[model samples]
Target chain A: MLKINSVGLTISAVPLLNNITIDCPRGSVTALMGPNGAGKTSLLKVISGEHKASQGEVEINRQSREDWKPAEIAQFMAVLPQSSTLEFSFTSEEVVALGRTPHATGTVRDAEIITAALAKVDASYLAQRSFVQLSGGEKQRVQLARVLAQIWDHCECEGDASTDGILLLDEPSAAFDLAHQLMLIEIVQQISARGVTVVMVMHDLNLAAKCADQMVFMNCGHCTAVGTVSELLTPELIKKVFSVDAEVITHPVQGTPMVVV
Target chain B: MKVLNTRLITPRLCGLLLLIALPMVSLLGLMTGPVFISLADILSITLSGNGGNSQEKLIIEIIRLPRVILSLLVGSLLATCGALLQGLFRNPLADPALIGVSAGASVGASLVIVFGSMLTANGLLLGLSAISVGAFAGAIITSVIIFRLATSPQGTSVATMLLAGIAISALAGAATNTLSYLADNDMLRRISLWQMGNLQGASWDRVGLCAVTAGFLGLLIPREARALNAILLGESEARHLGVNVEWLKRRLIIYSALGVAISVAVAGVIAFVGLMVPHVIRLLVGPDHRALLPLSALAGAILLVAADALARVVIPPAELPVGVVTALLGAPFFLWLLVVQRRRT
Candidate 1:
């Protein structure tokens, strides 16, 4: 479980994230949704230990975020940021192999895990291709493979064993095609079902509604609402936060709440 | 889709081939002076301690050997710094000379020479004549300052680093010029020769010192190969991958700066070898630092030894400042690269 309590982050007197308290239970998917510059990414950075809070703190599995060394925090939490800027021509296999950096493990097993991750994302074909040559959607999938490979052992889920880890993704589906987007959702669900937490910052409300177990909506660095999809998917709330007319309707196909704007 | 894993094989092969080629190239450098010394003569003289013609043996062992060895060490150190800096900055144009480290080190060495001369005229100075300490301090201070100036909340901006590097390079140049201005004609000539960068300052003791420094830094920098690879993914991503970004940056900055400083102290600001050698190597082997760093070292050594050999034979009697030959060789290649890059864009 990941918990944030009164975390406020300031960069030279400008509050990027303010007094944000939230909770992510184990084996669940929590999607952060908000308008642009709403601090969703900042909040995610704080939780991922990339940004330090000027006030308050984050606790993972009841462990203080500050107390945990970088390697320890990285052992469980994997973050995939928006819009990769990979400048080198490293092969997709090499990029995915970087996931095992934190684990003091042998390459033979790590290579197997990388292959599995690429296969899971349907990126097995791109494994030998250079990362710079991959298309946008392909790069996203490869990065997803990297994040997946970070916690591959947890996802292996031995008999009666509850696997543990957390995945933090920022706009993972931003440039993905329809098939890859669905593949991403399916893979994420598979990961959560294995008992790892998935905290994703997503822009697609309908997709988030269908996929996430809980929702946290932010506006101007403040958490305006935090609850299940049904509780947070009100038209008035979306209108007030997003400044757009939105209609909330139940999906007849999946029997879940959907937001149309 | 089924490509063989060449990244693993390429480095090993490049290293092995270079290891084989290095001694031959060094032997060529040993052979290429005004007085002809064949490989056979070199081997005989080296093994028996007295076989070759007496004058040729003196030239080989007493004069040329230390100079050639010093060239190899300085070249390797400079090129390694260049590769490390490029990796650290993530910019192909990032060279220690352009980024003020060499100029900064030159300033420190110059200050010592000028002020130490004053103190020694009255016999006030002792045990501090060597340029290494001064050069190392200067390089460290300049890198720290430039790094601080360029990094902020927006993260380390490449544009800012480049601009700051230019500004710091200018400042260090001015400081070095001021030191030269205060010196007499004799000291000024010494300063100019040092500034021109040469292997004439070579001695067995200096060669030993440089070899140890190179080996030490060479071992440690390549160990960060994996971390450096992750860093290319971006700072935040690298941090997420458990690479201590701040720590890595600090460590590389200090190590590369020292690497450049030591070389500059010995070779006296040889330019373009650091800048151009890595570019050439990257074109051949690509930019994986695991390969790039070690390969750049060997390439740097080979390039300088060859250039130094050319310097010896260029005029037949007087030696050319090796730095000049490198500039003449590198400038056109650099321009061609820029042209190609622009055309591609």
Candidate 2:
């Protein structure tokens, strides 16, 4: 489990995140939902330790974040940034293989994990292609596979109660097509089922409702609401947070809440 | 399961090819100098280790051999430093000169050439020429200043370091120009010749210095090959992958600065070998540092040896600067590469 204790972020005398606190349980999917510039990505960065919070601290499994070494933290946590600046001529497989850097797993096992991770994101065919030449959606999928490979083994060791993996994604599916989006939802659900905690910043309310078990609504650097889909998917909450009039209805087959604007 | 077939020439094969090419090119370098020692004579002298003071034996052992070895070591050092700097900056165009090593070394050498006589009476210090010591110190000081300028509580910022490097290079260039403006005719010629980068001054002492620096870099750099590969994925991503980004950056900057400073001290400012050799190797093997680093070193040695040989024979009894030859050869090839890449895209 991850705990964000009144974490606040200020850069250059400007407030980016204001006294935000949220508890992410083990084996649960938490979606950070908000409009543009709501500090969703900023909060995710604080949890990932990219940015030092101006106030308070983050704790993972009762251990202060400062106590963990970089290599030890990397063994269980993976982050996917919104965009990558990797312009070198690395093959897709090589890029994904970078995720195995922290592990001492031999080459043979690492290669197998890379292939499986690529397949999980439906990017197996792009394994040998040049990463720089890939389409935007293809690039996103490759990066997703990279993060997945980082924690691939941790997800499968279900009986090991001490090792819990965390995946933080920043708009991971923004460039994805509909099919890819659904595939990503399925992948998130599958990983969460295997005891990997997933936190993602999402703009699509219905999609977040479909995949995330817990939703945290953010507005203007503040967390407005936190609950299950049914509890927080009301029209008033949607209008208040997103500044848009929307109707919430139950999905016909899945019975989950869907937002209609 | 499919054998990771991506590159045109696999790194292993490219390495093997370069390994074979190195000695052959070195032999050619030995054979191509002004006196034109025959292969048979060169081999006998090399094999026997003494030829009873024959003129051919003396030339082969004393003059050409040391020059050839010096070129190989300097070339390998420059190219390896280039590859490391490029990886550290995560920019393809990054070269050792970006950190002001060449410009600062030039300024240092020029200072010694102009004022050394007044200070030392004889331009020697600790067995090294005062100029070499000055060049090495200048390079180290400039790099350290730039590193400090870019470091703060937030860690070393690559962008800030880049900007600082440019500013320092400009300042060094101005200093060297001022020295040249103040120099007498004899000292002016010496400064110009040093900047052009010649192998005519090759000696056993300089060769030994280059070899030790090359060996040191060879041992230290490859240990960070995997870390460099991870770094090509942005700094934060590299940190997320368990790389100690700050430690890696600091080590890379120090190693490359030392390698380049020693090279400039020994061989003057050899230009294109550092900037071009690594790029050529990267095109052939991709940017995986594990392969790119070693192959760049080999390719650099081969290119510089061949260029030094051509510098010897291009004009009878007179020699061109080896740096001039590298630029003359490298610039066109680099342009052609750009054209070819454009077409492919």
Clashes per prediction? Answer: 0, 0
Badly placed stretches (over 4 Å) of model 1 are A158-163, B1-9, B109-137, B147-163, B178-192, B329-345
Per-candidate TM equals 0.90, 0.97
Model 1 residue B36 CA deviation in Å: 1.4
Error of 1 at B241 (Å): 1.0
Instruction: Report the Cα lDDT for candidate 2.
Output: 0.89
- What does the lDDT read for residue A23 in candidate 2? 93
Candidate 2 structure quality by residue, lDDT tens digits, A5-35: 9999999998999988899999899999998
lDDT tens string, model 1, B1-345? 565332324667778888888888889889988887988999888888878899989998877899899999999998899888888777777888756787788888788777765443443111223565566678778877888898786556656777898999899999989999998888787777777788876778778878888989977988998888888888888889888887788788778877887787677889888888887676555577778888989988988888898889889888899999888767787678657544542
Could you give the CAPRI-style class of model 1? medium
C-alpha displacement of A28 in model 1, angstroms?
0.7
Q: Which stretches of model 2 miss by more than 4 angstroms?
A: A160-162, B1-6, B119-127, B340-345
